[model samples]
Target: MASSLRLLLPLLLLLICSIHGGRGQPCSTSDIRVEQRTTGASVEGQPEYQVTVSNTCDCPQSKVMLLCYGLNSVTDVDPRAIKPVDAKLCAVAGGRPLSKGTPVKFKYAWKTPQDFPVVSSEIHC
Candidate 1:
């Protein structure tokens, strides 16, 4: 019994370490790139923007989260009116994984008062 216990102890430790090791390994920020474009005009008289997230890593990226916010007329945007733009790609459960060199694209529309003019937007992954 003592001999078997000793053998199992190392195996158990190895298994635990393997399981937890991956949790510490997150995808590198440098491996991803975010690109933005204005896809024509808004269909419903709103401002529309398209964002693409590309994975430049050699490994697959899973459950990636991207947040986007839009600002209209930098100086005049109403504080109460500020809100996150639509994240079309964010609707996927557990995030949509991308293979190396692949890209994911989404669109967002900002609702602003007439003549508010969107000046800039920000995205973070």
Candidate 2:
């Protein structure tokens, strides 16, 4: 019984330390830009430009996904129907996980169908 207790003590301590040390990290976005322009002589014109969203975290993320949504400033456009390639490109920058302070770039070419109300975007991982 004494020998068994000694071996189990170290294993228990390691298990407790690993469990306490494990955590989920948060990823943040920064430097969002939107440029709008008129397409010919139409009242509703989609903007054409690429907005880059970067991951600013120390931990690596899995299954990262990016998406765009319509704002209240534009009523003629619906974001649900807008695919990344139609004007924007929703793609995986790379297969490897993003490192600390490293940015995952996403190129988007979309028209808001109106003026841009918000100058920021978001991502999920």
Candidate 3:
């Protein structure tokens, strides 16, 4: 019994370590830029901005969701006025990932409610 217990103890510990080992080289893309556009202005209050989220990377890419916020404009409104947006993968060019550093994009339109302060927008992944 003592001999079997000793063997089992080391095996259990080794099993735990392997399970916790770090996973390497996740599918990663370069930092993206938010291309903002004002589609139709409001007669009053803050104007609506349409954000086009994009990924500009040189590899096969996939959409990654991130936290986004507005800055320097309104203090009383939500920092991340909009929900998390997903990064898009670039389409294939001749059966390959889009050109190196080309962007894959998605559009998100939102309006800053009256009295909400915001100057610039940002996203955190």
Candidate 4:
């Protein structure tokens, strides 16, 4: 019985890690969250919003792409931070890794708040 437990333990651990992206924690594109709030500031007579993009995964998220079609900001967004890939996508962090818990922040001004949804990301454990 003890021998069975010893063999089973490692198998269980391997299964768990595989299910959790090998970092002892779950990782997915959903782990990327974008939060925005009005900064109580205005640019070009439009309300400005402070946007924070954070990774909740235990591993680093790289090549994060966001849905950015029709996104225009009176407050200039830094191209190096995020730039338009095409008509419907934007690359975040210049296609670099976003460390866990460290957020990428930016500001944009528009008549209405825009939603930046995570389209895809590669998790680096």
Considering every candidate listed, which one attains the maximal lDDT? 4
TM-scores of the candidates are 0.44, 0.33, 0.31, 0.83
What overall lDDT goes with each candidate model? 0.48, 0.38, 0.37, 0.87
Per-model clash counts, in order, read 0, 4, 5, 0
| Per-candidate alpha-carbon RMSD to the true structure | 11.2, 10.2, 13.5, 3.2
- Per-residue lDDT tens digits for candidate 1, residues 9-94, read 98987775564334334346455566667767674576676555676644565555444333332233322213333632222123
lDDT (0-100) at residue 45 of candidate 2? 52
Where does model 1 exceed 4 Å of error?
1-27, 69-94, 111-125
RMSD of 1: 11.2
Error of 4 at 60 (Å): 0.6
Candidate that beats the other on TM-score, 1 or 2, i.e. the better one:
1
lDDT of 4 by residue, 1-125 (tens): 99999999999999989867677666889889999999999899999998888998777899999998946898679786778899999999898999877888888899999889999999886
Against the hidden true structure, what lDDT does model 4 obtain?
0.87
Q: Name the lDDT of candidate 2.
A: 0.38
Error of 4 at 4 (Å): 4.0
Candidate 2 lDDT over residue span 16-36, tens digit each: 555433332234333222333
Model 3 ranges with Cα > 4 A deviation: 1-30, 43-46, 69-125
Question: Any residue pairs clashing in model 2, and if so which?
Answer: 46-111, 47-111, 84-88, 87-109
- lDDT ranking, high to low: 4, 1, 2, 3
